[model samples]
Target: MRTVDFSPLFRSAIGFDRIFDLAEAAQRVGEESYPPYNIERLDENRFQISVALAGFRPDEVDLTVEQNVLTLEGRKGDKEGRTFLHHGISTRSFKRQFTLADHVEVRGARSEDGLLVIDLQREIPEAKKPRRITIGGSSQGNLTQIESEAA
Candidate 1:
């Protein structure tokens, strides 16, 4: 596999280190793919992440948002002295991290029917939103009105 150099990107860009970090992570191979999840856009500013956690209970899962990073962790309880002939469900511990955009917040999280649903919403401040600038009539300098000739 070909390797990408990101040194040049850092020399010119500012406050984009997180983006470069994500790209570097994608290039790496043999990363964990357990605990499958999905991200859906409910609306223009609403989103939901659904993670399949069949054997894990609500208490075993933890969700936290800090510094625009959302982390989800699950610690499976030990199965004491139990032997299964055909064990299919996986209850392994897993940790997942998601980087959220500016102004995006974690609304809530709930578990239902073996699925863990996490809701997110982007709330932009009023000062940050775009507003139309009224172009009122203004004269740069002293302007004399010219009399129009009657037709």
Candidate 2:
């Protein structure tokens, strides 16, 4: 297997320092293999992130968004009442975080059939969106006409 260098791809050409932080976080993510997850794009502007949390309850999970980072944490309480003959399943606590873009926001989170699903949507503000400009004449001609009109 070949190792890839992702530093060049994250160069600050877009004037955002957060992208570099995201790249560093992504590198740290490759070291972990516990609790698999899947990310799928539902539509042009919608996305879903699903993680397999076999023994975790809905209340045991926490979802939060802070400083453009989405964090998902799961903690399983201790089973003190009963003892198991064979403790095969692992119920370790875990925390997973994902870096979100500037305008992206979390919609909601729900659990179904041992799977934790998180929904997210990107909403670009009207003023931040790109707008088309109309150009009628050449720059020099327009400048000369404006100057004549002013005189």
- The alpha-carbon root-mean-square deviation between model 1 and the true structure, to one decimal in Å, is 10.0
lDDT of each: 0.85, 0.77
Q: State the lDDT of candidate 1 residue by residue for 83-120, as single tens digits.
A: 99998999989999888988999999999989999999
Clashing pairs in 1: none
lDDT of 1 at 130: 55
TM-score, each model? 0.79, 0.73
**lDDT at 65 for candidate 2?**
95
List runs of model 2 lying over 4 Å from the truth: 1-23, 136-151
Error of 1 at 41 (Å): 0.6
- 1-151 per-residue lDDT for model 2 (tens digits): 3445556765645666566665666666668756789999998678899999998888888889999889888899989897899987777899888878778889998888889989989887665655545566766422112212111
* Best by the lDDT measure: 1
How many clashing residue pairs appear in each of the predictions shown? 0, 0
Model 1 quality (TM-score): 0.79
Question: In lDDT terms, how accurate is model 2?
Answer: 0.77
